[model samples]
Target: METDYAIIGGGVVGLSVAWGLLRRGKSVTVLDGDDGSFRASRGNFGLVWVQSKGMNQPRYAEWSQQSAAIWAEFADELGDATGHPVPLEQKGGYDFHFSEETLQARIEDYETLKAKIGGNYPYEVLGHNALRKEEPHIGPKVVGAILHHQDGHANPLKLLTALAADVRRMGGQVIVGKIVIEVSKPDSFRITCADSTTYGANKVVLSAGLGASKLGPAMGFKAPIRPQRGQVLITEKLPKLINRPSLIARQVDEGGIQIGATNEEVGHDDRVTQPGLSGLAAEAISAYPALARAQLVRSWGALRILSPDGLPIYQESADMPGAYLVTCHSGITLAAAHARLLPDWLEGTGAAPDLEVFSETRFAVS
Candidate 1:
């Protein structure tokens, strides 16, 4: 019997979509990549961030806000089902600025975006002294921060483990080590693997991170996405010195301060560089002086799956109507929306969201 949905890509994006569909009583199967695949899910800063996103697209900001609002409940449900603790701190997070000019400029840009989105962005501009009151370890070079109240961080590995477990708990099948090379829609969708294995489903979701570029064109998508390398660093577990998360650094639930994420335009190279690590360390130490004494634990580089416009793509294939391409950079931030609201869109329910803005038509199809 054909499954209701055969989801390609077992990363957080695909699994979250699978989890949502399974909650709606749909038969689902997830085809996960092997060990050799570039898994962004493993190498993220683990922030459920909202600030500084969607400066151009108000709808993208609104969508991220929707996901952030329900993230706690999503974590609780996942933990209760899988008995795995997914630690999340959602008090708020910061977008730090070292210069007054940049801070004011960002505030103006945010004001424009806030007006477009009906002023739902909850944030406060904290001066350095005010920020020091909240975080005493803040360095003097820091100018200020925009504390967006909807932001937070989580343990990504725990979230992934729990989702994989709960997907199976809900009777969803997960197949690993199968690289999907082709997809064809006959009466039902037939997914062909690189090794000649086949799976059948009434519908297909192409959420395979970087691999979507290879299969999307055949299934009717331009898939103009690229890989951006982000180098991240982690220090040894220490006593709480930082209170909130930033684009610069955040203390993880495991007691280590997570610093990083240098956005480099290196194609498909998720390997760390000395220069990348050094730059991240300088910025982190400048933000928090105490980090200068912290011992380094590990560092890594992960490739971010980004679209041409830095927005997510959620489009159903025009030629193959039942197949969809779902890719995004903020998989951790959008997991709640994908697991709760996206199934309605996929199933054509009246509650489906207005996702017309995210369609690939925005990009010129060659």
Candidate 2:
């Protein structure tokens, strides 16, 4: 079939782009992988976070803030269309600290980044007393917290469901369990899947997460991406014991305290280890104390796709025009930006956000 855009990978990144393009009257078809593929969207920590992001590059921080700003509108639009409320809380999120030294160091770094970003960063340093007042369940071991007003959390699964439903409702074709094997540009673009199914499109996008590592070079992309394993845990649903989300833990909308995310550089291995789970539990208990008595309900691991500098890479192919590469680890956080803003960049419109800093050219080896 012929389409305006043939998107490889039906994950959040690809689907978000498809949703945006379809909203603009673009004909799109999304080809997703099989069930055996590593789906990070299903196993994420569900954080719409902004604190401690883009410390070195203020542009990234600004991009995240941009997305965070529009997430409510984006979610509301999806809810209006699909009737699925994408639960989002932007009341603010925290970077809980166990000692004053670490908290002060982070504040110093944030101050520097804030200046670099023209003082747009909105955050406040909360002492133990202040933090306790905000979160009475906070443990004494937690010395302080940095509450970044832009940071928040969401129901990732609901967001994904809504995006898929609305994309289809908007006349976008979503083909699942189809692994695209090759993409070639002779006149337009021809994409061949492993099962010998072929698709024709005027433009193509490779947002296949970790799968980009293999398919990228053929499409004239460096695709310098790797997998980092993140192990996460969740407790049984109970009364609200947590007020907001921190790096250590957050109370999910369904009443379970979702504690997670041990970032380990295990290179494609997404298996949860006993040591990782124990360490995470210990830290959560130390932060909330009440978590020590909470019943542990579920635990799992997922792989995160990362560029060399831990930033999103947005590059149109140098060799093959009309081909683009979009990949990032913070899919849930940047979903709104991808759906609402990224289409402008992809379409080369006058309103496109200046994304030069995120181009793969930054990774060119000099």
Per-model clash counts, in order, read 0, 0
The lDDT values for all models are 0.95, 0.93
Q: List runs of model 2 lying over 4 Å from the truth.
A: none
lDDT of 1 by residue, 8-86 (tens): 9999999999999999999999999899999999999899989988988889999999999999999999999999978
Residue pair clashes in candidate 1? none
Model 2 lDDT tens row, 35-117:
99988888889999889889888899999999999999999999999998999998999999999999999999999999999
Best by lDDT: 1
